[model samples]
Target: MARSSTNQNVHSADDSSLDAGGARALRRGLQLLDALLDAGPEGLRVVELCRACALERATVHRLLATLQASGYVATAGRFRYVPGPRLGRAAAAPGQPNMAVRLQPVLARVSAAFGDAAFAIVRDGPHSHCIAREVGTHPVQVLVIQVGTRQPLGVGAAGLALLSALPDAQVQQIVAANAPHLAAYGGMTAERLHLLVRATRERGWSVIGNHATRNVLAVGMAVRDARGEPVAAISLASTLARMPRERQQLVARTMREALAPLAV
Candidate 1:
């Protein structure tokens, strides 16, 4: 897990950076948000938060009160704060400049390699969303996925790669959560998903055939964030005839090369 980062609005240049009046308050407020983000879905109590952010109890309370009113934080208990519903609502909204725009060029490069469609997928809660895509120029284009398509985090090759990169405990948690929903997709069970995740880990990538979509095969690898966490992935999808085991390896290597510079 990422350490409770306090560098968001603080840790900048000294007093000359901004006007003296409300700057300190702003820094403290951002520190509070950072600490709360690190606490995860379970959240942290007022006392725990105070210790994490190194702020006074009263100041933490004041900030929490303000944050709650602004829909940035929500109380789990009398003194605990979890991320608010507004954050989730904002996440699915389409107006923001998103990963697809940044990755469009990279996706084009991957698609060009073998005339197979490519996708950029990002983890959103327990699902991996196709945020960007580039269609191959081949006569038979494999449109396995498109921008805004979403699948359970362990379902598709791209999603499985992302899931395999997560910790074991978190993997189990997601398995449990998605187990109930998997039946609707294809009678997929958590146990089956677990097996795929393990295989993906050993292979350092994921490959799927006739699973999510029949006759379509895909190769995927996770991309790490600055924190070294798998936040996204790139995938190449084509007909099964085009993506043999040897070709899968080749495509994966190509994906790594094309996406390496973009990860930064």
Candidate 2:
């Protein structure tokens, strides 16, 4: 009876300790979130938040992921954090159709036509962010991206298209800033991205194979705003067997035609 009582006491102590640890983690997460809210849409880099919150790098990354999953924090570029939609500050003004809303039909049409996943991506500073997505009728669905996912300036097909549209000087600056983050993605480096920029500009469309996902191929093209600046991009993603060289060209042309009348 005495031994049983002792074991119970030990278990109770462990439970208390775990509860305390959980509470501390929650408090730290809130601190990180507060830091992001103060940073606003302009956002703050992970290192900046680590300094501001006096937290370790790994801890800050974990907290940011938790907050982002809950819609409290959003990533802008590779590691930059911004206040998310849950904060109630919409990016759109009153009466202006949001870019996501305006592009939904376009994405749906592309997905339906190609029987693959289609995405709408926009330029967020030096990053490309997936703002909307559409899944096709194919039973074997490949969901590689979702809304709010952010990629470096030249990392993915959408990003490559966006980067290819920029002038040489601006591309150099953005590529330099994103260089360090590129290594994390398999075979992606600053030099390689510059090569992709050249090829994408020459082809008038970006083609990425097996980079974002194994054995998946994606074709992308930039959508110009009213001023003729490439402000956004659209991509069609399918298996390698589906996107042959000939099919890629055909899809690129179709994407250009579909997005021609889009105002923004």
- lDDT, candidate 1, 85-163, per-residue tens: 4564566547645566767888899899889888888765566778888889899988877888977787788888988
Among all windows of 10 consecutive residues in model 1, the one with the lowest summed lDDT is 1-10
* lDDT (Cα atoms) of all candidates against the true structure: 0.79, 0.82
TM-score each candidate: 0.67, 0.66
- Write model 2 residue lDDT over 37-146, tens digit each, in one string: 78755578889999999999999989888887886776554556777656533545678887788888888888888888898887655677898999999987777788
Query: How many steric overlaps does candidate 1 have?
Result: 0
Q: Model 1: runs farther than 4 Å from truth?
A: 1-35, 40-98
User: Candidate 2: misplaced stretches above 4 Å?
Assistant: 1-93
Clashes of each: 0, 0
